[model samples]
Target chain A: MADPDSNDTVISGVAPGISRSAPQSKEEVIVISHLYKSFGSNRVLQDFNLTLYKGQNIVVLGKSGSGKSVLIKCIIGLLRPDAGEIFVFGKNVPELNHFALDELRARIGFLFQSNALYDSMTVRDNLEFPLRRHWIQVTQAQVNDMVMEALEDVGLAHTVDMMPVELSGGMRKRIALARTLILKPDIILYDEPTTGLDPITGKEIIDLIVEIQNKYNTASLIISHDMNCVRLASDLVAVLIEGKCYALDTYDRLKSSTDPNVKPFFEQ
Target chain B: MATDTTLKKFLDETGRIAVFTGRFLNEWFRPRYEISEFFRQCYIIGYKSLPLIGLTGFIIGLVMTMQLRPSMVNYGVESQIPAIVGISIIREIGPIITALIFAGKIGSSIGAELGSMKVTEQIDAMEVSGTNPFKYLVVSRVLATTFMLPVLVLLSDCIALYGSYLGVNIKGITSWSLFWNKVFTNLIYADIFPAFIKTFFFGFIVGIIGCYKGYHSSKGTEGVGRSANSSVVVSSVLIFITDLLVVQVTDLIGYG
Candidate 1:
């Protein structure tokens, strides 16, 4: 699989300096160990361990229904795990109170699979929502500037006044990305960033992911099964299987992996 | 065995609702009050519901007066129409009808709204955005419905009384002062205060039930529909049950 397959490595080639083979530094931004989560009898994550470093984009690659979303939710303290510790920035996520969690969340951005844009709000209002929500004290003019800058980051400055409903699927996704960027979160979580878009739009989103990572220099934990996204956006790939980190390695290394389970993911 | 499971489900739902209400009570009074969202909900839940509430109240009042006219006239006491209709509308009919209408409209919308938000991960988005979804969505809405229903009921009562006056004028020439005087004379503090006070409870029941159903909504689009449907049904039934309980209490306390 690692025979320099031109198609697989195409997106990576386009965005130079994106696909890193290893962590650049030892600054562990997120250290999750022995994380076990289950809903009733369905154990989604079992003994999951992965570490994210500063300025790294680690994509947790898993098939559909492999508990990728569950893993992200636990890190943000949205769903308390059955047994585990998710340490983001040295503080255990589960141990934090509501106020503490909110404080932590301000520094961590999450882009939902569905975009989760406020349907009732205009794009401008949607972008402005998090500013007022986190009680970030900024004047109206600064808020506008921040909103524009975030929109500019996604190359969707023209869509500032449009409603989410009016935007196409890709535009909505971009708007959602803009909202996530508005917070300037230290660690961003992308949940299926390329799932619903067309292949072309998906590639655009992947390129944006790489671009955003480069410009903002923020660490990211992206959850996806899309190989295109996997190739273009990941610094290191963490393969999730049967509620555990089956493999955590580079794309090229994993492509060449002879493990029966790990080989199938690369073949596709 | 089926009945046993059904009973268990009932108890479970009730317990869950109680817990949900407890959370709301605990969170609503704390800091970072969403004043703008609260007012926005008031505009949506309260102001927007006026026309329907008014129309229903007017129609019912007109119909009730016309229906009672023949019976009062049978005993040559047709002049008691205003007094009878007034007392009944204020004490029982007005509040219940307005509340049921409210349950149908606001309850379903709130359910559908929060249910959709839950399904779409917007609720989670709000949370990850560092804003409490319960505080921003549920509390503001519940408070809006609780405060606004009373005002809507008061307006509904007034509109309904005017309808009754129109209905009275349809049959005989009763002056506005005489009609209003007779209506007010028949209504005591016991009737007005208890009826008015009970609406706050009705509003709260509608708000809390709608919020509960929507906030906890599961599945997908179908779940959103179920949330909307169940919120209306549950709040409507609870309103009647609460009315029965309140009426019995008032009777025991000599307010009835």
Candidate 2:
């Protein structure tokens, strides 16, 4: 059992046994090592480790309750892992205090399993929330431009004044992506972005995910069991089995993997 | 061991609530106040609750006055009705009734609103977006309730007095001026000030407890309803407990 109070460390390169090729750029954005999290007797994440490079998308594919959401929450500082270092931008996430974690979150966008848009606020207000929160110095005119630009990025510029409830499921997802994009964060964490949408809408969301990654050159960590999403969006796929990164490989290579634990995901 | 576990849970919950309160205090004085949202909450939590509080106050005053008339007549002090009603309404009944009404209306609203936000992950979204939900959601609301309750209580007290005047006029003849004169002649600084001061505490309790419940809401949509229900119940109980303490302190200090 790992010590619950262990401090985080900065490390280079992927851990041993993660055989996928590293990104061309050596700049690592987020690194998780020897992470352990548990709830009572149920140990959710045990000795899990992964390294996310800049401008890369690593989809952690897992079954429901496999701790994928826990991983994302820990990265974004929503949950504190019992042990291990989650280093994001040179600061350890669990070790960082509230103010520090909040500051870090500004630079990292997180899209929830739900769209999580303020239903009470207009679409314009949802997009403006991040800008006003982080850059209070920005003028109203500049904010309008940024809001429109983000909306345009998601191809929902017309829906800016509309309430979140008025939008369809796909539109809500797009608007949420736009809201996350308004901040122009360096990293974005998507928790099952394609879930609960029709196949067409899901594909559209995946396309948008890829497009945003290219346009912003942002490193994204997507947690999903959606095989289509894993196939389309992941620059590399990390198979999370029983609270550990069981395998790390490209989509094609993982599809051909012979291991039973890794085979089931590819078959789907 | 079961007792120990329950005690620990209670202590932990208390500590968490205290921390939540401390965090609000720390972030309160920081810059970039959400002025528009604060005013909106005041409009919603304060201005919107006046009708309900006023109606309750009116009924209480009228009923109290009518019931007291027979007793006063028995004691041969029927003329003292306005003075007695005025002191009771101003010193205690007015604030307590208005607070209970405010708690039901505003406390549940705050809890449900924030709890829905919590269950939907809107609060998390605000946090990840670099907004302080505590400052944006909690501070403005707590401040609004703290400031707004006293104003509502004051307004309710006046309305209750008018109701009492009407109640007095129903069975007997007393001029409006004379009724008001009788009511005011007994009203004093000690009675008004202590009652008025305690209302701020009432408002604070309602606001903080509501926010605390909603902000920490868990389980799901069911949690939202629980948060709203528990906020009203807890705040109402706390209001009475606070009133009891306030009365004791005031009495000890010679205000009684």
Candidate 3:
């Protein structure tokens, strides 16, 4: 049996610019410490700790059923952990009430694996939904400008009148991203940003992800298994194995490692 | 042991539904209500359902009058046809049938719509976007159904009465005034008010059940279908059960 690879440095606590103790800096957007979650007998996440700093893209890479999605859900306050504190903007996620959570969510964007665009609503309505929902008072002209700007960010300005069902898969994904961008969230959580598309489309999405990060300077926590997404988009890669952060290091460093557990992923 | 577990599941579901209802009530009066979406839902759920309800009510009234004419003639109460049919239709058949039709149409639509949204992760997207989905989707729908059913029922009752008039005219000459006078004479406040009141509850039950089934839908695409199917069946059964309770209450209050 191979020992779990704990030799790699944990980027969240050990990264040069960030302090290990008392994470009170405005730079740290999300700090998930000692997170443990399970459904029934299946322990999905155990002692998972990660800190996302401002303007960083952290890709959590894992195999299928490795609790990657669960981790993202926990960070977004969709699923409460059995034991842990997920501090987002100095407020614990699980501890916040509904209104407070809503307030926090306005500042945090989430790109779902499914894109999750509203099929019944047109593209313009889809983008306007969050603005109207959060009660962000703006003139119609301002809303139109904001909507167009978000669409322009994703290079889909012409799709405003189109329904989601009318768009192709990659187009729909862009629309979903545009909707997320409309809010101008400080932190964005992406769940499998390039799952169901072809290589070219997937690469295009990855490029869009980088472009958005560069433009907005938002902290992004992306959960993915796609190696292309991992290699291209990650500022740092956190390897999740057996419900724990087995290795947290750069993609190149982990790829060059000879450790049996981490070696197989690189070999693939 | 099996029975105990089944009973426990039943209680758990009931409690969960109650909580869902409570949340709706709590969120209803909050700021940033989706008034535009509410009207849009009303248009879809209520206005679009008018033709179906009207057609069904008309057919019921026509067939019922034709079927009852023979019995009335044999009993020498043929002239009382308008009063008898009007009383039966207005007091019970009209509202119940209209509500059932509304339930089958709007209830299933709401269930399938929300179920698909849940499966597709649209609801989750709304949540992460700082949108109140329960308020935007569920409350608008519930309010639309609750307020619109009574209006639909009233319209259906009128169409049904008109159909009954056409049915009556097929046999002999009956003036419009005579027919309407007979109907008004037999129809009392007790019968009209209680029946009207019950349809609101019927609408409420349909909307809530559909919302509950759809909002909590799991297991992907299969779950969406199951949510729609179960929403129809559950709302139908609950409509009857609630109608029974309403009848009991109204009777106790001397409405019957």
Best by DockQ: 1
Scored against the true structure, residue A138 in model 3 reaches a CA lDDT of 95
Better of 1 and 3 by DockQ: 1
| Fraction of native contacts, model 1 | 0.84
What lDDT score goes with residue A197 in model 2? 96
- Cand. 2 TM to true fold: 0.90
Per-residue lDDT over A1-268 for candidate 3, one digit per residue giving the tens place of the 0 to 100 score: 2244354445333232221122223488898899999999999999888888887777898889999999989888888999999999999999999889989988988999999999898999999988977778899999999999999999999999999999999999999999989989988899999999999999999989888877888888899878888877777788888898777777777778677777777786
> What is the C-alpha RMSD, rounded to one decimal, of candidate 1?
3.8
Residues B1-256, candidate 1: write the lDDT tens digits. 9999999999999999999999999999998899999999999999999999999999989999999998888999999899999999999999999999999999999999999999999999999888888999999999999999999999999999999999999989999999999999888999899999999999999999999999999999999999999999999999999999999999999998
> Tens digits of per-residue lDDT for model 1 on A1-268?
2232433221221112354332345788999999999988988999888888888888888888899999999999998998988999999999999889988988999999999999999999999998988889999999999999999999999999998889999999999999999989889999999998899999999999888887878899999889989888887788888898877767776778776667788898
Kindly report which residue pairs in candidate 3 clash with one another.
none
> What's the distance in Å from true for residue A229, model 1?
0.6
Cα TM-score per model = 0.95, 0.90, 0.94
Q: Taking chain A of candidate 1, what TM-score results?
A: 0.92
How well is each residue in A63-172 modelled by candidate 2, as lDDT tens digits?
89999999999999888899999999989999998778878888898888899999999999999988877755788899999999999999999998899999999999
DockQ for candidate 3: 0.68
